[model samples]
Target chain A: MRLQFILSEIGIGLRRNLSMTISVILVTFVSLTFVGAAILTQGQIQKFKGEWYDKVEITVYLCPRDSTVPSCADGEATQEHINQIEQVLESPEVSPEIREVMFESKDDAWVAFERNFSDRWWFTEMSVDDMNASFRIKLTDPEEYQVINEVLTGRAGVEEVRDQREIYEPLFDVLTKATLVASGLAGVMLLAAVLLITTTIRLSALSRRRETGIMRLVGASTLFIQLPFMLEGAIAATVGALLACVALWGGVHYLVEGWLGQNMDWIPYVTTGDVLMVAPWLIIVAILLAAISSIVTLSRYTKV
Target chain B: MIRFDNVTKVYARGARPALNDLTVEIERGEFVFLVGASGSGKSTFLRLTLREEKATSGRVLVAGQDLTALSNWKVPAMRRKIGAVFQDFRLLPNKTVFENVAFALQVIGKPKHHILTTVPETLDMVGLAGKEKRRPHELSGGEQQRVAIARAFVNRPDILLCDEPTGNLDPTTSLGIMRLLDRINRTGTTVVMATHDDEIVDQMRKRVIELQTGELVRDQSRGVYGSSR
Candidate 1:
């Protein structure tokens, strides 16, 4: 029976402050959407790392016929130079770091170069004689690129050692920084949501001061008097969270999955499942925001 | 029953004490009037019994529990045993008469069946039986006070505290309110009323405790408003 009274009180309070309640809902919705976006962006970064990191390779380029480097001053790499390089790769000192090495001859490099730039206007300016043969070395751990670089640098016929991860680092760095920016925005918006909820509850409590005074005089417990106001905030925040979840789901399903996935098939994108995974946390955060603000406001405003 | 032992209430720093170092006691089932001019501390006295204000130097005990020593969490339980009526009637303006009265029992978690039965009975006793559906604004001043009275007595409290319950009513309405209070007191509930109405005080001829500028000046059984002074 008391629960019925409290529930009815909550309804009355919401109705009495409908505009303020709507504002709270909108503020919470916008804030939690930012929170969901930040979480999903982090998830997207993890997906990218998982998909790309294992396939990265380190390439060791051999000197070309016209090379000017001191290590390659002996002119185009000889068969002996190639043999010595293969022996070093298979040596016990470096074999553990190297998963497998495929040697690409100048002809093979020329073919790949043609296939890549065939559509460009400068295609005819490059030829097989200008192409440098290279060893494509896959590592057991992509992070162990430095060990191979240290062993191969300045070696006979070796012109340059390049880790593929370096090429991808700037892309990943941009993404990670984007996630940080989103999280920073989310933090500011959440603070605004908390303050709006606090003010809404304070106004509600103040408007009903006469009723609250009577309730106090009639022996209503502090919790009993404050529950209706607290529930008012919780209900608004919960609705906002629900709206945020819907917005996130639509964004991930249509924008990320449908548009970005179809256009950029090679890049993995966050799915609706990721949005679902973050939904509960969003709702929990909303409730926690309401609960904390209500506790702070009610403590000062609803004292018997 | 209520007891005050050298109770003093100081509301602010460097201001006159609201209630001076004074002592008084009223036994169970007694109907007493606390009569004083404004600022004589009549409301403070009621507040002390309700545990709304902490006495600076002394103790207040109601229904055998030391209010000063009671923990904050236990105050609601202490107040539940006491019914209070105010000068403004203090009914929820939006709630119907029946809802206003039923609210008291509902807040205390009374069973639905008990509320369904007791609310109408209490309304009848306050002469607001058929007017249960009316809101506070829809009622006359006396009817509104009756609703307040019904809400106070619905839970069958051990003591009823009134702070100018008839202050806003005409003489005839005030008399009706006093008669209702007398009827509730006749049911063996202790009654403490604070009022400045001389005619009601003289007519009721109950025990009167008079305060003059925070000092207890008189206490008399079967007394008129200023007969003891």
Candidate 2:
């Protein structure tokens, strides 16, 4: 009987404050959508790192006959300098650090360059002798690029040492910054949600002061009187969270999986399963927000 | 049973106490009236019994429990043993007469079958048997007061406290309310009512306690409203 009464009271309160309740729902939905997007963006960044980082190689470029680098002042690399560099790579001390090594002569480099730029007019000006031979070394740990670069750079025949990770750093930085922006917006929206929920509960409680006063006189406990109001906020917030989940699911399905996945098949995108994983947390946060706001407001308004 | 041991209630920092060193007691099944002018501490006396306000210096006891010593969490349990009615007939505007009466039982965690059975019977006792579906605004002023009374008494409380329950009713309606109260009192529920109505006080011929400027000035058995100084 008490449960039935409380449910009825919640229904009455929501109906009476329809506009305010809808505002709470929309605010919660928008804020939690940002939160969900932030989580998925972080997951996408991690997925990219997992897939790309392992293939990253450190390239040690040797000087050519026409090179202007100070280390190449003697002109094109001698056979002895090439033999010394190869010995260092095969040394027992560096063997564990090097996963695989490949030597690309200028002839081999010219063939790759031609294959890539053959359609461009610039291809007519390039020749085999103008290409620089390089040693490409794959490291057991790509993060150990600094150690390999220090070992190979400033050598007699070397021009420069470059890690492939530098090529991808700017892309990752943009993604990380995007995640931060999403979280910042989510934080501000959540604050608005809390305040709106507090006001909604306060107004509902004020409008029903007479009924609550009567409830108090008849010996209703403070919890009994406040439960319906708290549940009102909780119900609205839960609906908002569910709407957020639906929005996230739709975005991931249509935008990420349907469109982007088809065009960029190499990149791993966050799936609907990820949105489902975040759904429960959004509901929990909504309930907690409503609980906290109700507790603070009810203590002042429904002081039984 | 209720006892006021030299209870004094001061509302503000420097204002006069609402109830000044007042001492009174009413035993089981007795009907008592508290009559006074607007600032005579009549409502304050009822509020003290309800523990709505703490006494400034002395203690107020209801059903043998020291209200001053009762913790905040235990106030609700303490209140369940008492019924209260107000001048405004504080009913939920959206609920029917039956729902208004059943609310009291529902709040106290009564079972569904128990509420369904007891609410109609209590409504019948208040002469609102066939008017269960009517809203408070749809009913007459007297009928609204009856719904309030039915809500108060439905829990079978040990004591009933009223603060000018008939103040808003006409003389005829007020007479009907008083007779209903009288009938309730005959059921062995201790009733303490505060009122400014002179005719009902004299007509009922019950024990009357009158206050003047926060001090108890008179207590008489089978008293008339004007007989007290």
Lowest-sum lDDT 10-residue window in model 2 chain A: A47-56
Model 1: how far is A95 from its true place, Å? Answer: 5.6
Query: Candidate 2 chain B — worst ten consecutive residues by lDDT sum?
Result: B220-229
Candidate 2 ranges with C-alpha deviation above 4 Å: A82-131, A138-144, B227-229
lDDT of 2 by residue, A62-128 (tens): 9998888998987888788899999888888777898999999999999999999999988888789
Q: Among all windows of ten consecutive residues in candidate 1 chain B, which has the lowest summed lDDT?
A: B220-229
TM-score of each: 0.93, 0.92
List, for all models, the DockQ compared with the true complex.
0.68, 0.73
Model 2 steric clash pairs: none
How far in Å is the alpha carbon of B71 misplaced in model 2? 2.2
